[model samples]
Target: MQFRNELDFAQDLDQNDPLRVYREQFHFPKVGGKQVIYFTGNSLGLQPKISKDYVDEIMKDWRELAVEGHFYAEKPWWDYHERLAAPLAKVVGAKTSEVSVMNTLTVNLHLLMVSFYRPDNKRFKILCEEKAFPSDQYMLKSQLRHHGLDPEHALIEVRKREGEHFWRTQDVIDKILEAGDELALVLIGGVNYYNGQVFDMEAITKAGKSVGAAVGWDLAHAVGNISLSLHDWGADFAAWCSYKYMNSGPGNASGIFVHEDHLGKKDIQRFEGWWGTEKASRFMMKPEFEPISNADAWQISNPPVLALAPYLASLKLFEEVGMPALIEKRKKIVAYLEFILGEVAETVSGSFEVITPEERGCQLSVLLHGQGRPLFDYLMKNGVIVDWREPNVIRLAPAPFYCSYEDMYQFGQILKEGILKLSTVDSLG
Candidate 1:
């Protein structure tokens, strides 16, 4: 698929896009009365236009039905979380019974760790990627401390070779088996937040289990952006936030996947709550905690209908377009972005290297060597909404749902202008 530097070429692609109509479903941010080219779906997705209506429906239910909305509202607030199960299951590639929407991502991560990260003396180490998102790092550290173990001694990180931004797949597998009996759990991001490298979860899971350890992933950036097969991959459990690629608004509820193999295990320890109890005896108020038969057992609280509303709004788009179609669009647009980045390098003084790998979904993490915030500021002032990472990376994700090929082309033009300005500024100073 040869790509051209022409904006018209990009427009032609968008004109033929089957999912082009979905761009209208979202409301883009505006600056100076013009729409901003938002490429930050990897950080925070743009809001869907219909999300308001979905949330309003829940508000109306609460206003009219009051307590009875628990059972009588359109979705029945008591089991409202159930609404997203099947759709989210499709997004993450799991059985309906294997998926549940409940707590926020890190909270769910901790809850899952309670069941999966059982570190015995023989297997007391937890292996994860180096420089994971801070929340995951903190969680792992605190979890180790809670068990009276030291993080420095109990945590192992898979490292990239010198002079590399991304990890090699074989290196990760080697680390998993290298730890062997000493590794109790393997927890990594399904798609890396910094480099946008999609890990080979199936191979990692197989390696971890072969060495007698539980395996899980934080799918925050992978859920809607990639085709997942968590059930087939044999991951013990996984969790993800819906706000990024899922576009469920800021800090919406998260989705969880507990493999069917672990669903019926009564001996697994968890923080029990009323929502986790069997529906048959939920209102009975039994002193005993009889957990639900499947992944719903991980639910420590009932779902928040208002917050969960936007999930319904966003996932409907996913159902309509399907991941396969969305993935194809993602590839085309990202290729266009990659092509444009190359064109910019011919004119810009400083080097800009892409850290994201070919296995990545939509994001391209750009390393702006010798140029910093000035370039990012220029892009922002010009209504280009990309995210900046510490030290020097800028993340640009052309989301399949709302972002178009024209947006990618325009972003390249804006970025080239920014680079030219920054190069001149640095030279003058």
Candidate 2:
């Protein structure tokens, strides 16, 4: 497709976009009485207009049924989360039995590690990417500490080669082989939050398991953004926050995937809780814990209906549009965004380096070489919503669900103007 840096071209693309209708479903924040061109869906998704309706339904059930809402409400609080398992499974490419909605991302990761990250005298080290999301970094360190191990010794980070911006698949596989018998687990962000690179999960999982290590993914930036096949890839476990591309609101309920091999097993080591027990026998008051026959066995508490409401609502959108359609739009839209960025770079004196590789989802992390925070501030003030990282990188995630082609074109124009203006100011000074 020939790309053009014109309003008419962008509008023509948007007009023909099959997924364009989805943009109207979300409520965008207005700046200066105009809707902002949002590119931060990689950070926090815009709230779905239907999310309120779902929340209201749960609220009405609570108000009218009171305590009886647990079993008697329309979406019985006892199993409200079960409704999410099927759709969430489709989004992450797993069986319904392998997926469950539960606590937040890092919390679920800690719990999953209890079962997957068993260290021994021969195998005690864990492998992950260097400069992982800060929460993941802290979680890995604390987990190592809890097991009486020093992070400096037990944590193996697969770093980018010398001045590179991305991790090569072979580099990670080679690292896994080097760790060999010493590697206990391999946990990494499926889609890196910094460079927006999608790791080769299938190959990495194979490599980790070959070395007698467990494999899991932090899919915070991956889920609802890229294609996944956790079950087919033979991943032991995975977890993700839904507030990003999933649009489940801020810090909402997380979804987890425990492989079918791990499910229905009483011998597996996991923290026990009343909610994790069998549904029929939960209220029987029996002392013995009978784990659920699925991923719900990892759940430690009853469903948070209020939180799950938005999630379920969001899943409805996924079910309607499907991941295949979403991915189709994602590829085209991201390519268009890349094209626009290239066009802008050509027109501006400032150097723009897109560190995000071709194996990416919706995000394009731009390294602004001759720009800084003031340029970012200029963008924000101009009603272009994007995410800024340390040093001088801005993350622009044109989420296919809500971001339009015109938004990409407009962002290019705004970005070009900001760079030129900043360059002018520097010259004058």
Candidate 3:
């Protein structure tokens, strides 16, 4: 915990880390031959070396069994999707029956909205955070139009107070109360994608439910990075993509959560598909639709096993390390990064600010005064992989599973050099 300087601190932390061995399992990108400092896990996770083997197994089964792979193959393709439920449930902190792997993130969001966001004449407004992921915003708007409602009138975007970087817990509660009788559903990201704020899900859910509105979340940024208890938190539903921290390759299948309380409700509406029919009668090809009794009822088609294999591989890693331990490691790594940044900020000419520390996950948004794109491009060209948001902010995520304390320190050093070099040019001019 004590260090002479940043590099010393990083080396010391790396030497003592219990999860240090995990870094070897992932396929970190190389520049010439050396591994790049990969801080972009918030965007796309590093692939597991085992991910190829997992996919190859499925491919082999497909090639050998052809159409018969579903029932006869090892691990049986027909029930392959069900295999993911228990492990994924543990990852999201839900009961096994409450979770299921399914379509992409946006698709699952729309499907959940169909059943949960039942807007009526009086309670027709849907509440969400401002600046949610663009796909989420588009889905909400399209869903509103599908129901013959004007999005401008029906969508309520809860924004941060003036000049603020993130919303306080009370700010969200206040908006839900203000919406009151008009609020039909509250849907927000589990973590703000741009700023990395981890919203208070339990508080948000309680507030929405108090107003008799359904509550849901888009967990794309939060699921693998934080410990979530959607069942105990009383969240009505949630959805997440696996390609980021989950390490499930791009455009991989997403997962969904539905509280057990909503499962038996006969009146709840969903877009029916044959795969969602009662498992006992699914193969009967019956004309009548008897939906499955759990969250799987939301499924529209049989799962894509190839897309799921990588997730299965990653989830195994989660089970081995466990969420609680992973979160503890994340806190240490994040705090270390924060400390280094604070030190560098004091020595630098321009102001540097962290936008979402109070309510955030592994990622941090840093604002560089008067310089944004130039610094961002400089960092990327130097083999430090951070992402630039438009205008001013740069997002760096030191993920727990594969990112190291050494990685954070090195990236911090690179950032300081970038800032110092830019300052020198400014002074010369």
Candidate 4:
């Protein structure tokens, strides 16, 4: 809670960390044989050491059993997808039947939209946050066009107050009310990718419900970073990629959640496939589309077991640590990062400002007064792997699973040096 400088705080915090042992489980990247201070878990999580073994198991099954792996393999390829449900459910705070691992994030987003975003002529608008992840924005617009509606008129974006960098909960609620009659669905990021703002999901869901709209979230950033209860929160549906904080390898399989209440609604439309067909009769290759009565009904094809092994490994770590413990540990690390940044800001005469602390997750978005890319490149070259968004923002996320207090401390030092170097260069110009 208190630190004189970044290193001092890091040393103290690391000494007390309960989950510190888990760091050795990951394959931290090295530069010149030295481990880089990797704060870019928001982009790609460090791979778990167990991932190799998990992948090997699947490979072994494929080699030995050949095509018969579907029924004869150890875990049984036919039921391989079901293996992820219990652990995946634990991560998203949903019942086992309420969650399923399937498709890429964007693909699952379109599938969910098919069932939840049934826009009629009267209530045809889709509500979302401004500057949402570009993929989501593109998907919403395309969905509108697919439904024979004009996106410019049919989509509404909730934006920040003038000159601000984040949206307040009340602002979102007010916008939903303003679009009351026309709003059919509200889709928002669980955490804004650029600014790291974690929206108030429960309140947003309530507001959407009040307006007679279906509410969903894209939890790409928030899934492993924060605690979630999609089922209890009454979220109609949600989807996320596992590569970031979930530490599933790059372009890994993604997941989806559908509330149990929506399971048997035959009126709701879905783009169905044979994998979603009734499991018992699926082998019969029946013509009738009898869907499995749960979130698994949304699956369009067989699971990719190779892609899913890493997720299974990473999620087992989550189960061992538990969400509440992990979140509490994260709060300490994040608060430490924030405290050090404040110290640096004071020395720089307000040259840098943290844009979204109140709404932020572990990530902090720093806005440089006049310098941007040079400072980011300086940090990157110095072995600190923070990410730079376009124009002026650099996002630093201290993910609880793999990030260390020492790493945060080292990053603060690297950042301060980068800023000071930039200031010197600017003065010469």
C-alpha RMSD between model 2 and the true structure: 0.8
Deviation in angstroms for 70 in model 3?
0.9
Kindly list the per-residue Cα lDDT of model 4 for residues 318-407, writing each as its tens digit: 889988888898888888788888887777766778886576677888887756788888887888888988888888888888888888
User: How far out, in Å, is residue 147 in model 4?
Assistant: 1.4
* RMSD to true structure for each model, in Å: 1.0, 0.8, 1.3, 1.3
The runs of at least 3 residues in candidate 4 whose Cα sits more than 4 Å from the true structure, single-residue gaps closed, are: 6-8
lDDT of each: 0.90, 0.94, 0.88, 0.88
lDDT of 1 by residue, 208-301 (tens): 9999999999999999999899999999999999999999999988999999998866678988899988999999999999889989999988
Tell me the lDDT of candidate 3. Answer: 0.88
Candidate 1 vs candidate 4, lDDT winner: 1
lDDT per residue (tens digit) for residues 72-122 in model 2 = 988899999999999998889899999998999999999999999999888
User: Which ten contiguous residues of candidate 1 have the minimum total lDDT?
Assistant: 344-353
TM-score of 2: 0.99
Better of 1 and 3 by TM-score: 1
Off by over 4 Å in 1: none
TM-score of each: 0.98, 0.99, 0.97, 0.97
The better candidate by TM-score, 2 or 4, is 2
What is the alpha-carbon RMSD of candidate 1 to the true structure?
A: 1.0
* Structural RMSD, model 4: 1.3
- Backbone collision count in every prediction? 0, 0, 1, 0
